[model samples]
Target chain A: MNGSSKKYWTDDPEMVERYVLGRLSEEEKRRLDAEIAECEPCREMLRRETLLAAGVRRFGRDGLRSRLRRRLVRERRSPVRMYQSVGLAAAVVIIAVGVGVYQMFFADLTRPTQFGKKEIVITQGGEIGEAREEKREVRTPEEKMDAPPPEAKPAVRSGAERNVRPAEAAKRTAPEPIQEFAPAAKSDAAAARSIWLLGTVVMETGAARTGAAALSAESRTADAAAPQASPDRPVTLRRGDVRNDVALRQRPLSALPTARRSQMGSARRVETLVETTGDGGLQLTIYTDDVAASELDAASVETLDGDSLVVTTATQRILYRLPPDLFTAPSVRTKR
Target chain B: MAARLFFLTPDAEILDLIRSGDEEGLVMLYSANERMVRVFVTNNSGTPDDAEDLLQEAVIILWERVRAGTFERNAKLSTFIYATVRNLWRARLRGMKREVPADLAERDDASDEPSPADALAGSEMAAAVAAALDRLGEPCRTLLLLYYWEERSMEEIAAQLKFANADTAKSKKYQCKKALERILTDERII
Candidate 1:
């Protein structure tokens, strides 16, 4: 082994490559390892190769480990836990579907049949009764004279009172014989009232109106009721007709009242004149028809002092007296 | 019978006992090789912190390989452990951006009790060696340094720097050594 000329175990290129990648056969590796013990040259070669391989591996490992660790942490802290989460979600979906199926097929089965039957009976009787009342009211002129005066006066006056004062018309038509007619008229009036009540309830709860418009109506109704009950509460105005008007009004009010003279400052365009109150509040008078009752905020009352009402916000410390009828009058449309 | 068997069995039996998930084997291994691993790491241009890190890494590798039944029994356990430490050091060096100085190769000799010649302070031989290395071109300097410091084989030196073959690497190494010797002789350090 000392005088051996074969350098295959010494400086062999294939042997070096195998050693570097750690792919050498056990016997070959054993021989080389033994030779390395006696030979400094072989030892040195092995050291350098080992260093190079380690360095490359370290670089690769550092990049790979960071990426893998991040992925692992993300997976661990995800919104849903891994194992049972899918099953739980599937179960919830199944339950929802089952409930939907039951509602589609057997919903009416759960309702009381007797109540429906009673409603049908009442509806049918109501129609016949209405017809009978109509026939009785339309009797011949000779028999019509026998009809009570209370019933006759309301029917005649309601049509003719437009031309005459209501008090004078009612006085001329009133008679003692009309007492018995009150019950029939009351019943007819009750039926009409119930129809409107049912319509209102359906509009409130039923799935008829949808999208932004319906939501706006709901918000408006809520706002009207809300402020009357509580004054200091914030008013939530959904984007709608009322909101649009208020927003349009607010734009001009919020605008910096510039001294620049333009169409806004012109006398003809200024339909409403604002005057400051003693407390630095404003008074506005708009020359137009009455504003709608639906548009009023019940919590705040606009007093009709001529045609204007004083408005004030303590926080703003600015007073605005605006025309009560400004919104009602035809004016330049302001964009919100 | 148990006493006789225990007496006949070598310390390897005790080591096996420790190796079989035994705390004793871990203690023994750490006690024996910790310093060697640390020295190997430190001497190879690693800081004390880096030494500790490499030592731990090498121990962990050994423990895992042993546990996995992949550790071959050809080499002595200490030698195998040292080899592992050396491999780790080599790896760190290769990974470094800058080349390690060749003076690090002489560190082991420095640690041994100095000979009278070495003990004489500010020796001309040291100056000559430094001057010789400085006079050599970059290629020759690199070749000599890699040869002494890393103790790289001709084949490895060729492959690492992408030489065509081991013969070329050996020829270059021989030329660098001869040039270094000529400079030393001219400086009258040899």
Candidate 2:
């Protein structure tokens, strides 16, 4: 042990760790302490080790504290408190049901029925054609919600709702039916004779109450047709890109986006849909309840306005304005 | 509803949660024992803030012990926490009692207050160490904390971290420690 110079205790890192953590035996601890007092490097090493240990301890404590505080805030916001009183929750549900029932019957009766009679005029070969009206029935508030014109029947039955094609419905209900647009006889001859079933809707305005009903029918139609076309990728239309006045009217005020509400300011709802005629032609249908000035020729191609294909029907002079890109990219159909 | 269930969770389940490193159990422990700690602290001349701080500290101590496998099951977790809180509050009260006026402390030779230089060095050292640990990150930071602060065994650390064995854990610890030392040296911290 008696060399010219003593071998430093700091040479052994394990011994230094043991000494720092107070794990050294009493004799070894005393020897190290004596050496540490004499050696400046040993003292510095010990100090750093001690600081590192304390810092790690502090870091652990701070980390735990932060996590605990965050969890506390989250727990406070959690809905666990809802189940604490089942009676209060039941009472809330009951009150909601009562309000809904009152609004459905009593409130509806008090509301002024601005129900406008609508007629759909279909034209062929870009010539002014007659839309012979047949059996007309007084539309219920429910029918008004659907906003289907004279030709389109309210498909009240769930199964019938699936395929509520206005042209087909008109043919079935109309006694002296207007001539139906001929579908292509075969896929090979599809390009030659394409039929464009242009529907012109005429009506009088009073459309504030049909928001929810309009959305349900519109969404259901979209959902039903979505699988047949573009089954892999769903189509997403930007606001104002495709507008359904009926759906917009039926929409709950709070449910409408701020940007949408601003866009629809002072603009009347004109429901329209563009269906692919299988042979490259487009079947455009318009549904509206706004009062018309005069019935224009429905068959005239000149009726198709700029961006908006404005068709003043044989009865109602209703203008249907569409987004500029509607005809160019006609995949996403709007609900009328 | 879950919060109510947590309040009713037995000590064994709470301990299991601690062992599993679940913070939910710690939260439950913090919440369930809060009233008792507050009552005790307030009665003993402590403020609500003091009670909260003491409770957090006590819960942390319990967490550390349980995680490190050093906590004895002889007493309930709440009992251990309460005892720890009591000890901490007593120490704080003693420290308060030892406080002297600045002038008296300067005159008194046996004062325990750190010199300005020592205080500055201590804070700087703490800051540097913290910075180095942060830079180290991940399993390295946690491994060092488990070893140095929590004083967990290599085997326990291996199991917790899903390492192969104690030897692998020890080797990893060595590598992590060297990496930490390099960061500290690069940053002129150690």
Candidate 3:
């Protein structure tokens, strides 16, 4: 040790601490020990350091130990840690349920899914319709004309619709009952002639579709006009392209994109299928193929015609006619 | 591996708080770690007031260590805090001439359930040494704690205490040790 700093070994208490606390390097420790063995004063200092070092170490150890215990607890109680675990579990369950609902129920409501549903519903409707057609098949034009209109039957009627004039009432006030169209002639040549019954529709969408179009037009006009412009702004269709400009001038139903958009906006998806069989007697079957995302609220069939006569909602329509020979066949006459 | 606390604040913030001597940090540290400290003190023959006083002193000691770069950052704050309180309470009990638990004399062997050991002839010297430490100014007290008690390196002490270099830190440490000895000699406790 340096002679100048040698007395401070005992004079400076922390020097004795270095020796007492064993903080010195191995060489220093060996040197300090040899000095302590020879120097009576240094040995006395070592005894004092031994006592102090033990106390200080105890204090340091206890302080450090307590801090560790508290840290463990804080770690366990940390909200972020707990929430992460909980949130992941909850998210998984929610996603599972959502996917299940989409596949089981919501998926079926979509346009594509409704196609299958509509096909089934259309089959059911066709069965009911075919039943009605069978009843029609048995009756001759003469007997049909003699009977009252089916709409007049109290059991088969409902709503203001029942009293509404039939669509073709103007053409047939007396209703010749198909004698003019397909007479049940006794002549074989007459029986063989192709008979057609022009299918007539009961107008349902005429007011609704037109109203929707007007609303859409009004909305467009209101939206396009400036804030300072008058509320009575007339709707103006922008002719952005040559085709649209020509279409607007023509004033056709396909005048503008808005016109087509309005038509499709109010329309729901639909499909129809028809199957004909010649077993026993001429039989025709028809059913809907695709229905809208919602319920199949209405399904109807009439004549040998289509899903509808006048509306773009038909999707597809088919018709079939039976041979006139069926009415006057010799097998039926021989049986009589 | 520790999870972040509220507001996702970093763990190092605790050291900053202690270093800065912020009142809020002290309060938070107390509330956060009080249950462990209070339980240890009261169970070991201390009153609620003793627990509270010891906790306050421990926090001050921790701040001093942190401020002077004497604190072992690797150690958990809770363990350090509670242990400081326990040690202080035991020292105070010895000063009061009360019979300390036999297990309190020896250092803990990690099991926490203290086992009795023979008391040394110099057990009475603890209070005298602690008083001598208290007489040393803030710098000297912290330097000794860092060098002798906390086992911090001279280079670390230089950086933490803003010494010019490790040599200056060593010189300053020798001066502080001299100061401590002077207090012990003047008091005639060592």
Best by lDDT: 2
Model 3: lDDT equals 0.42
Model 2, TM vs. native? 0.43
Report the number of the highest-DockQ candidate: 2
DockQ per candidate: 0.02, 0.18, 0.09
Q: Using Cα atoms with residue i matched to residue i, what is each candidate's TM-score against the true structure?
A: 0.20, 0.43, 0.30
- lDDT by residue (B61-112, candidate 1, tens digit) is 4543454344556645566666665555554566675565564323221112
lDDT of 1 at B54: 60
Question: Which candidate, 2 or 3, would have the higher TM-score against the true structure?
Answer: 2
Q: List candidate 3 segments past 4 Å from native.
A: A1-17, A20-38, A44-336, B1-12, B19-24, B43-45, B60-76, B79-164, B168-190
Q: How does residue B119 of candidate 1 score in lDDT?
A: 29
For model 1, the stretches where C-alpha displacement exceeds 4 angstroms are: A1-336, B1-19, B101-190
Candidates 2 and 3 compared by DockQ, better number: 2
Score each candidate by Cα lDDT.
0.38, 0.51, 0.42
Error of 3 at A292 (Å): 92
* Model 2 agreement with the true structure over A102-137: per-residue lDDT tens digits: 643345322221213322222222212222222343
